[model samples]
Target: MDLFSLKGKRALVTGGTHGLGMAMAEGLAVAGAELIITGTTPTKMDDALSYYKRKGFKAYGYLFDVTNEKVAKENISKITKEIGEIHILVNNAGIIKRELAITMPVEDFRRVIEVDLVGPFIMSQLVAKQMIDRKEGKIINICSMMSELGRNSVSAYAAAKGGLKMLTQNLATEWAKYNIQVNGIGPGYFATSQTEPIRVDGHPFNEFIINRTPAARWGNPEDLAGAAVFLASKASDFVNGQVIYVDGGILATIGKPSNED
Candidate 1:
């Protein structure tokens, strides 16, 4: 349990104002990490800060576009000056455009790539420089099932995530010697507000997810907390460049036939 403690550690989570990012950030806070959350929305940031404070966690918020390397660099510097040096970085900021590859605009595809893949790259580079100097750090990229399998209407997303998986491994290999661990968390279908509509009874997509997952249910946002904590703490010091899938066994097997038990 001591190995899992993150006391006195500063964790910077990009896009952490809501959804799964918030869930993971909360997990880190519960394990004693000081939170430095980043997001693009002011209202969301305020709400998240209030929530964290209400829960008695030390938290700070910064707003910025992570994909813009220049702005991100400035903000990272500002954060270090005002808050503290970052010991853990969760590259969870990303975007997806649900359009068919055939019909998707090149700009939209590029935008998705910029945010989902390049944003992590930018954030990691800036943060890892500090970690390299200190000789220790943790980096967790939020990946997805698309990182492994192809899905309809998500061509750009799959491409970016697949690239991210490789990037995780590559970064881990390079930084392992410096005692910096780079890992990824690939989530499965989850019961988020974004998915609430499709998660209701008898919805085709909801039923599909329920039947598809070996665990027989969609993942709860909280289901991600433990993995996030592990990857950010001393518990995973030796774990590097790996993507831990939290998709309820969705990737462990081919989907069962709709008629099969």
Candidate 2:
């Protein structure tokens, strides 16, 4: 139980303002880690901070574009200076542009890669430097189901996430000796605002997801908290370079035919 306590630790979560990122960050906070939230949107930052305050967790917010190496470096340095050393970092900030591969603009593809893949690399490298010096840290990359499976109209996203999966392994291989554990969390179709309209009963996508998953349901955001906390805590000190798929058993089996059940 003590292995899971994050007291005396500071966590920096990129894109901690909303969605799955916010969910994981809140989990760490609940485990006793002070949060350093980073986002590009002021409104979201404000709202998130207010929510966290209401929940009685210590948290700070920063604004930055994670894809910008210089800006990320600056913000990391500033946060280290202002908040204290960041003992944990969650590379959760990302963007996805869904479009047919044949027609997807190169620039759009590049942007998705930049945000989803390159951004994690930059953030991890910057944070890992300090973690290396301290000889201890935790880094979590928010990966996706697309890291292993492909879907229509998401070529860029799949590419970025796939690359991110590999990045997680490579980073873990390099940094494990330094006592910094790097891992990833791959989430499945979830009941989020972005998916609300598509999640209603009888919606084609919703129906597909319910049937596709072995657990017969879309994942709840809360489903991710336990995994996030485990990977961020000392409980996982010996665990590195793995991507825990918190996907309602979606990745574990071949799907039953839609007509069978």
> lDDT winner among the candidates?
1
TM-score of 2: 0.98
Q: Would you estimate the TM-scores of all the predictions?
A: 0.99, 0.98
- 176-236: candidate 1 lDDT, tens digit per residue: 9999999999999988889998988999999899999999999999999999999999999
lDDT score of residue 30 within candidate 1:
100
**Local distance difference test values of all predictions, in order:** 0.96, 0.94
* lDDT tens digits by residue: candidate 2, 1-261: 999999999999999999988899899999999999999999999999999999999999999999999999999999999989999999999998888999999999999999999999999999999999999999999999999999999999999999999999999999999999999999998888899999988899899999999989888888898999999999999999999999999899889999876
